[model samples]
Target: MILCDIGNTYIHFCDKYRIWKNLPTNIDKKNLQADIYYISVNPENEKKLLKAHKNSYNIAKIIELDTPYEGLGVDRKAACLGIDDGVIVDAGSAITIDIMHAGRHRGGYILPGLASYFRAYKQISPALDKQINFGISLDEIPLDTQTAISFGTLKSIVSCIKETIGGKKAYFTGGDGKFLAKFFEQSIYNEMLVFNGMQLSIERALKKYEEKK
Candidate 1:
C-alpha cells in the first residue's frame, strides 16, 4: 500500500515498506500505481490526486463523525492518530499545533510557518530577502539581521509550542519537524506520522468493505 499526506506546500508519501519521500505540491502523475490511500489539506488537490489514481481511496469517504469535531480536516485527524493524548505539530507551509487530550481532539492553532513568516517579511522588506541559517539553537542568538529574523521566528514557534503543550509531550511532523525538534526537549519527531495514520485508515476501510460483503 502507498500512503500519502498532501499538504499545501508538499506531498509526503511512503510505500508499504515505510520508505518515505516527498515532493513539491505540483507532482507528476505519471508512473504511479494503484492501492493508494491519501489525505489532503486542500480539496482541489485532493480531487486531482484521486483522479490520477483510479483505484485510490481518500480516508475522508470512509470516516463518519457527529456534531462536534465533524468536518475536521483529515490532515489533522491523521496527525492525531494512535496517540493517547498530547500535542501534534505539523510545521509545514503553515504551522499547525493540534491538541488531543483524553482521546479527543481539542482543535488547534494555525500560524505562519518559519518560511511563511520570512516570505511575508521579505514582501515588506525586500532588502532582507536572503537565506538565513534557521538551524541554530535558541540560546545562540546571531547578530546579523537575516539570522536574527530566522532565529526570532523559530523562537516564537518554540514559545508557542511550550505555552500550548503545557507539560504535555509533543509529536512533531512535516518537512520542518526535524529542524524544529532541536528546540524542544520533550518532543518526538516522527516523519512517518501521516503514513502511520494511513495504515489505520486502510484497516478501517477494509473492515467496512468486508462488512458490506
Candidate 2:
C-alpha cells in the first residue's frame, strides 16, 4: 500500500521509495507498485493526482479526509487518532503538537519547523547568522546566540507540553520526532501511525459501504 501525506511544503509518499520525498513519472509499478493509495490532499492536488492515476492503477484507491472542522491538518488528526491521550508532537516541515485528553482529541499547536526557525534566523539578521543542527538539546546549545535562539525556543515548547499535559501519553512522529525524543521520554516512535489511521478510515468507510448492500 502507498500512503501519501500531501503536506503544505512536501508530499510524503510511502512506497518502495522509503525516504525519497518525490517520484518521477517514469517509475514502474513493479518497482514501486502499491496495493492501495491513501492520501489527504487538497482539492488542487487531488485533481492532478486523480487524473494522473486514472488510467494506470485499477486497484488503487485514494481518499481525501473530510471532517466537520474545516481546514484542519489531516496529519494531526491522524496522529490524534493513533495515540491514547496527551499530545502528539509531529516534528516535520511544520512542528505541530496536538493534544488529546481522555480519548478525545482536543486540538493543539502548530509552529515553524526546525529548519524554518533556523532559516528565519539566517535570513533576518547578519551577526546572528549561523547554521544550527536540529539534533542539539537545551543543554548542548552551543553559543548563547544560537542557544537562546534555538534551545530556548525548543525548550519553550517542551515547557508548554510539560505544564499543560504532563501525565498523559505522548506520541512523537514525523521527520524530526526521533531526534527530539530525549526531552520527552514518555513519547513513542510511530512512523506509520498516520498511514495506519488512514487504513482505519478505509475500514470504517468500507464498513459503512457494506451496510448499504
Candidate 3:
C-alpha cells in the first residue's frame, strides 16, 4: 500500500505500491495497485488534497480518519506510531506532544509554534515581536525575549514530557526536532517518524479491511 503522511508543505511516505508523489492527471490505476490510502489530515486541507488528486483522474481509495476525537489533529496520532510506551514531540508550526503506551494513545498538548507565536505577537504589538531566525540556545539560559520565548516553549514541552510520560523513551520529529533534542536529557529524532506511523496505519487498516471481507 502507498502510505502518505502529508504535512503543511511536504508529503512523506513509503510508496511500496509505487504511487508517484507527482501523480499524473490521467494515471492508469491498474499500474498502481495500492490497497488503501491512509489519510490523516484536516478536513479542509484533505478536501484540497483530494481535489488536487482528482484533477489527475485516478483516485485511490481514501480513508479519512475523523471521529471519536472530533477535534483531534491527525499529526499527533501519526507521531504516536513512532514509539511504544514513549512520548513524542513534534515541533513544527504547532508544537505537538502525544504520549503513547502499548498500543493505546494517550492524548497530548499543543502549543503555538515559534513562528506562530511570533506572528501572533507581531500582530498584537510590532514592538514586542521580531523575526525569529533560529531556535533558542537550549544550552544556555535565555538572555533575551526571543530566547526566553524559545526557552519557555521548549521548557513547557519538556516539563510536560517529564510530568506525563516520566522516563519513557522519547522520540522527537518535525522540523524543530534538533532544536528541541539539544535540551532533552535523552531523545531520538527521526524526521521520517510520521512516515513510519503512516505505514503502520496502512498495515492496520488493510488488516481490518480484509477481515471484514
**Best candidate, lDDT-wise?**
1
| Cα lDDT tens digits for candidate 3, 21-106 | 42223333443344435454444444554554443211223223322445666667666764667778888777788777775666
After best superposition, candidate 2 residue 159: deviation in angstroms? 2.5
Weakest ten-residue segment in model 1 by summed lDDT: 62-71
Q: Single out the weakest 10-residue window by summed lDDT for candidate 3.
A: 55-64
Candidate with best TM-score: 1
Q: Which stretches of candidate 1 lie over 4 Å from their true place?
A: 20-31, 63-71, 140-142, 208-213
Give the per-residue lDDT digits (tens) of candidate 1, residues 16-87: 755554454455555356577777787766666776677766776653322156467777777777776888
Per-residue lDDT of 1-213 in model 2, one digit per residue for the tens? 665665555555665336334433333344335443535435555444455455322112323333344566766666666456667788887788877766666667677777887777778888667666456666664566766676756786677766655776677778777876557767777776676666666677688799999
TM-score of each: 0.85, 0.76, 0.68
User: lDDT (CA) for every model shown?
Assistant: 0.74, 0.62, 0.61
Q: Model 1: C-alpha RMSD to truth? A: 2.7
